[model samples]
Target: MNSTKGSMINEKKGRIGCVKWHGDLMDTRTFSNAGQDLYVRVNETILAQYAKSSGSLTKKAKLAISIVSVLLFFLVVFLVYWLAKRKSKGKERPDKFVSRVLTGSTYFEKSTADLDDENTINSSELPFFNLSTIYVATNNFSASNKLGTGGFGSVYKGVFSNGKEIAVKRLSKHSGQGIEEFKNEVVLIAKLQHRNLVRILGCCVQDEEKMLIYEYVPNKSLDYFIFNETNRALLDWTRRIFRGDQNEANTNRVVGTYGYMSPEYAMEGLFSVKSDVYSFGILLLEIISGRKNTGYYNETYPDSNLVGHVWNLWGEDNALKIVDSSLVDSFHFNQVARCIQIALLCVQEDPTERPTMSAVLVMLSNDAALPQPGKPPFLVKKSGTIEDNSINYVTCTIVSTR
Candidate 1:
């Protein structure tokens, strides 16, 4: 009974004890009190043999587990690297997009990364106009159909078989503005719904052909009438005289037409909504007086520009003297005088003195006291040349990567 109690105590303590059956001997393994192996068998000789053989077997099993763990760790790392590489390799390049546009596909299919169901089409919308259609429309770009040239390229008028009038400004092969202007006009005009500005209907970029399509203004640009004496007379309310200057390089120094450029813009290249205001001022004066801002000449008043001359007349309260005699017959003196004041204010040398388009529109629509304008720019000298007042003519060019 005492041995049975000792064995029960050893079992509870997890001491290894062997149960020897009649045929096969089964060993029950447990830890010793000191945490060493506790082996119990029939004899000491059996225990010694078992301990020696199990040592090498246990070491081999541990080695197999370590090898499997290392292999699994390496396999996981390799899979992660391969997945990252695949993701990076799938990224689309800009050149690839350009090539796609050049391929002449009728329908443009956007990449999954480029668009989705909630896709908002900005200027970068796929499926642009076909090059073949534009070529056929322009009569293979005949010289006779050419209208006017610009910084980017030449404008050609095209009449489609359906009698659709279209003007295509084909981008020059060497033009720097083609890509950027294409994107800018597309994005800007798409969102801006304005009446005064020329409307851009659509654009096309196919096989290196970048073109902008605008709603054709039948009267053409304001320059057509403002620059020529005969043409100026046409706009002078009936039959009256009007007069213009600038070189090509100086012309392109600023955006917009030559005679139409504000003195501030022509000299300083300072542009804003006010810049357009300055242009509109020049146009207004040309329309009223039938005289060009850049072309007026008089020996008596060597410093007489259209703006300066108008300012003198306004001060004398004889501003009506400058108004074309033909317009005098049918024109409202009150409206004409107010328009002259507004034009003079717009042409002021100081940009801060000019009003925004909204403000200008308001002032024109209502009777409001305008602030006195500062000195107008391009104060004409003895010669009919425009003088630049600003220092840095070449401003930094903004480039878009995408």
Candidate 2:
């Protein structure tokens, strides 16, 4: 019994020794794991701080680039504007005379009304000639100095003291619509600047007297050459140029020459840009045929006018017969035919059927297919009695026989 007890005590001591060794191993493993965790946390904190610093630097760089780009863009725009302004200034030199005419005021701030007086004429930028100067230039309105007369007024040839030649249009006192016509001439001519249109040099308005000075057209009006048998030869190989205004002006009374007046204008007193076109068509026919529409009467077709005569000839395919005898062989056949077609198109009774001036120019320049023309407005035979309507027709009889 004593030997058995000693053996059990030895086994108990061995077991206790084993448990203490296992506990020591567990403590060592726990300490190693804790140290590893601490190192990982420290690395994570350092990485976060470095990333924040990098992000801040990137934002600053982007901001700097944006500011620089905007500055460069503004600088480029400013430079371009400055250069353009400088160039335009160099090209357009402001003329004092033109400026004064446009503004209706001189350098002295004197109004047109003030400048109208002969004493204050020096204040005008436009060459202002007093009544005395004009009188001396035109030889006191001598009959021999008269160049021509028109619906508006009579034109006189004037020679200045300095030997400058001028054509002066003296408004007639007998003309009831002279004031309105004078105003229209001044306003209209002053604004126009074209090679084909006559240039207005200056004007004179002194107590019941109004006159316009124009650059002398040596060849005279188109009608002078186109109408005259001897002068018509001079127009060979030369194109007749005519300018038409698109804007229409309404008048209370009809105030144009008899032959050139459109049917609508003559009868109803309704005039438009198309009316001018109609008149131009008549003029064109006159130019081509070398015959006046009103004055010329065909004994064969006693009732037929120039327009009717051309239309009939065109239908018969013998339109070339109507061409001026002098220009028949000289002028281009194709061009003359095209002009006749264009003229017929222009004189169509329906104004909308006619082509615009731009289209006419295009057709004149190119060989495009032209649209068929409708019936032209028939010219009324001048009987002693009025034909269409009972409307009072007051003829502005200042005829141009130049």
Candidate 3:
């Protein structure tokens, strides 16, 4: 009988635990629904006593507790905000990440759709370089050390005391470019370890001087070769033709020249990874023909640019006629034909039809069957003047004529 009574008391205690406060302070109600009703009854007495004590606490003490809780909440919020801001500010530019993606310096999205927020970069390790160090490296911008000029500014060759050769691209004050492009190039190229593309070592932003430092190419650009007859022979025997395709080889072997600029880049400047593919095609043609694209030839092929001449020879089933005489005996006819076809494909008027760099690599590497190229634009001879209808800077307007 005593054990039964103890069980009854325990059951009663559990029933009182279910009650919950509801409604406003002055008009509160207790909820008691189903299983929850059991606890409300079991814990009622204990809860009433606790409530009585809680109701009598001094308002000042209650206010103090509230203030402390609010302070604690804000402190946590502030800390999180501060940390996030610092992290975002710490992120590096996107170009570096692009380079990393390209060169396999880092493995990431294989396609455009795969890019996600998580693959962000941390900021540059060196925020900025001292102007004095840059001046010392460039020999205070000596004329003899000058490399070349671009839209952004003049590039100068620099050699550090440690035997590191560098190209310093110094931006002009009123140049149309911005810090963003420089940062983009730096972050992109630094991570990209491609043998074909140039490498960016570092950058310097001091007062008015915004300079980008790159690894020096001893022979400089491809323009040095394809633009003149004397220099064009360096590409003789089509050694440069084969050399340009080794995008995965030594960094020094990559070709970049002026007359060798791909039709897409020269016409539209709509560059992608394939822009280099197009460039390689032009360079290959220049090597084989020993001719420059922009140079004036006879009127029969007055529209006869280098690419057009090669195309004409290919159509007549006499592609060998275009090959330089210097390598007539040793040059592989099959290899030369395939290269010319690939070059023509790269210079196609329609950008959409152009093969990607990876595709070009495959075509060059294997015995894969290549596609027939469409007739290129500027195929016909024009009388008198030729107009460049390219877009203008700042306004970005395209000038069209009848």
Candidate 4:
């Protein structure tokens, strides 16, 4: 056998040969001369060149991977930084909005100035006057000028030095209205213009003090004349009672006289025409008995108000015994009892069972045997404090969650 090395091309050749190698990078060739024995050739120069080229390609692949990893790391850092910046801005937005409201115009007005016309805001008459202005106008909230107290706070009659009459409704310190809510109400009232709704003149907001100012229209509240004995005889209050209806809306903040609040509205913030029916029932009972429904105490029933006491009298067929002395001889016994039944119907625990104002009119106008009422909602002391028992019902609901 003849052996040649380092070159594939032999100076002399005759026969071809090939063999597999198990474990090394090898470039092999076979050769023969003049039909002699087979010859082998190994080219180390080509093998070295291939090895160097492979190493160079491997190094290039590693460098490319390292560059990609570094670029990805920087991208992650940039994304995190951007998200943090956005979150910080979000945290600042509410404070900025409130600052704008307190100092001058609200953020909404400023932001939407280009999009909305100045005349579109029905707030030209609504002055966001300072607390000092209201303080002076209200004579430091003297008790003598106070119109009446409400569920939220006391209302005072304010006469400006210029002889403008204004009503100042001072919000209680314990009231749960936050600045956000107060701001929203200010904006909403400013935009509303209606005769039925007393025109809101302005608001007063200062350190721990919030008061709503309304244009004073001289008229006593319905409760005033209804509960007053001397004034009760002047007008046929029963016929003048059923007034009007409105589309009911639910609110997070429930505000009304304690005695007048409905079960669903008082406890769960759910209100509808049924709520009006509940209030009307209270009024009806008051009118018939010439008594206020709120503070009336019954020695027979502990922690029970006018509703529970009336319910007891009603169940026992002694309903007329609970009537006002002034009304006792004036109206027929049957008529008074029937009115009690209608009031009970209005104060039913289930809103659906309560008669609408229209139905109430029919019942009052006719002597039809009225349908029986469900249990009326009342306050009872289970834990030493008067608490509402209306939440035990399975079906009571608010409009929806915020």
Q: What lDDT tens digits, residue by residue, belong to model 3 across residues 1-402?
A: 011111121134454222334332243245574222221232456567777877777676899999999999999999999999888765634444334424444432122222122221222242234667778878899999987665556779887666677777787677654454454444444445344445455556555666766666665445465455576556556455444432222212212233444456656666565655655566567666766665555456766667777778778888777776666666788887887888888777676788887788788888789999877655543344433333222110011111
Q: Candidate 3 local accuracy as lDDT?
A: 0.57
- Which of candidates 2 and 3 reaches a greater lDDT? 2
Assess the local accuracy of residue 69 in candidate 1 as a C-alpha lDDT between 0 and 100.
Answer: 99
Query: Could you give candidate 2's per-residue lDDT for residues 1-402 as a string of tens digits?
Result: 011111111122234211111111122233532332111112355567878999999999999999999999999999999999988865542233244335563322213342234422442434455777789889999999998776567889887765667788898899766766665554444444344454445666665567776655554655666677787776663544431211011111123555566777777788777876786677677777877776645666677778888888888888888887877656788988998999888888888887776787788899999998888877445654333434323322111222
Q: Worst lDDT window (10 residues) for model 4?
A: 393-402
Q: In candidate 1, how many clashes are counted? A: 4
- Stretches of candidate 2 off by over 4 Å are 1-128, 176-180, 187-195, 239-255, 385-402
Q: In terms of lDDT, which candidate is stronger, 1 or 4?
A: 4
Which pairs of residues collide in model 2? none
Q: lDDT scores for all predictions?
A: 0.57, 0.62, 0.57, 0.61
User: Judged by lDDT against the true structure, how good is candidate 2?
Assistant: 0.62
Each candidate structure's TM-score, on Cα atoms with residue i matched to residue i, is: 0.54, 0.59, 0.55, 0.52
57 Cα displacement, candidate 1 (Å): 26
Greater TM-score among 2 and 4 belongs to: 2
Per-residue C-alpha lDDT of model 4 across residues 69-103, encoded as one tens digit per residue = 99999999999999999998755543343444445
TM-score, structure 3 vs. true? 0.55
Best by TM-score: 2
Sort the candidates on TM-score, descending order.
2, 3, 1, 4
